[model samples]
Target: MTEILGLYNYWIVIFLMMTGFYIVIARENLIKTIIGLNIFQTSVFLLYITMGKVTHGTAPILKASHGGESHGVEHGVEHGAEHGHELHAAAEGHVDLGVDAVKEVYSNPIPSVLMLTAIVVGIATTALALALVVRIREEYGTIEEDEILEMDRNS
Candidate 1:
C-alpha cells in the first residue's frame, strides 16, 4: 500500500506533465503555449521536490560534535543527546540506525542538479518566448495567433 501511494504520487506528477504538454500542443495562442510550458516545467519541479524529501536523513554536513570525538568514524549509534550522533557507514553497504531506516538510504544528488538545470532552461525559454510575443504584438498589434493569421490573410 505504501508503494502504491508512492506510485500514485508519481502518476500525478506525470499527469500534470501530460496535461501541460497537451495544452501546449492543442492551443493556438502563443501565450497559452507558454503557460503550458511553464506548467510542464512546474510538474517536473514537483516530482523533484517529492523525490528529494528524506524522512530522517540529516544534512550532508558532518559537524565535529555530531560525529566521533576521536576519528570521525560514524558507527551509527544514537547517543543520549542529538549532539553526539555519528554517521554509520555500514560494512554490508547498509547502515541501520535502529530507528529511522531512511537515514541509511543514499542521497540522490542527480535530481537536484537536474532541477537546477531545468529551472535555468525554463527561465531562458520563458524569456525568449516573451520577447517573441512582444515582437509579435508590435508587428500586428495583437497576441492571438489566429488573429495574426487572419491579418496575414487580409494582407
Candidate 2:
C-alpha cells in the first residue's frame, strides 16, 4: 500500500491518459479531435519519460554510483589487493573493476528515443490532419462532421 502510494508519477500518467481518451472519444469537432489526439500523445510521452527516469541515478555516460563516491571503490580495491592476481592486474594498470565499483543505475534511453520518433510522427500526422481540415473547409465552408454529413447527403 505504502509502496503504491509512493508512485505518484503513475497516478498522473493514468489521469492524463483517461482525460485524453475521453476527449478523443467525446469531442465532435475535427479540431477538438486533433487536440484530444495531442493530449493523448502528451500522456504517452509523460509515461515514457517517467519510465525512463532512474531514482538517484545518472546518465549512462557517467560512472555508476555505489551509494557514495569512490569511497566504495577504495574498499573494493583493498579487498581485490588481497586476491593476488587482482593486485597484479591493478599494478599493471589493467584494473579489474569490482562489483561495487561497477554498480550502475543509468536512466534507460530507449524510451526517450522512442518518444522522439513518436513526436516526429505525431507532428507529421497533425500537419496532415490540419491540411485536410483546411481543404475540407474550403470545399464545404465548415469543419464540423455533422455539417459535412448533411452537405454530403444534400449533394
Worst 10 residues of 1 by lDDT: 72-81
Per-residue lDDT tens digits of candidate 1, residues 1-155? Answer: 99887588889999999999998998778999999999999898889966876656544344444343323223222331244333223322222222233334435656777888999999999999999999999999999988999999999
TM-score winner: 2
RMSD of 2: 8.2
- In the order shown, the candidates' Cα RMSDs to the true structure are 8.4, 8.2
Q: What TM-score quantifies how close candidate 2 is to the native fold? A: 0.69
Q: 1-155 in candidate 2: lDDT tens per residue?
A: 88687788889898998898888898698899888888888899999988988888766554534445456556656866788678655543323344444466678888889999999998998899899999999999998989999999999
Candidate 1 residues lying further than 4 Å off, grouped into runs, are 1-3, 49-55, 58-106
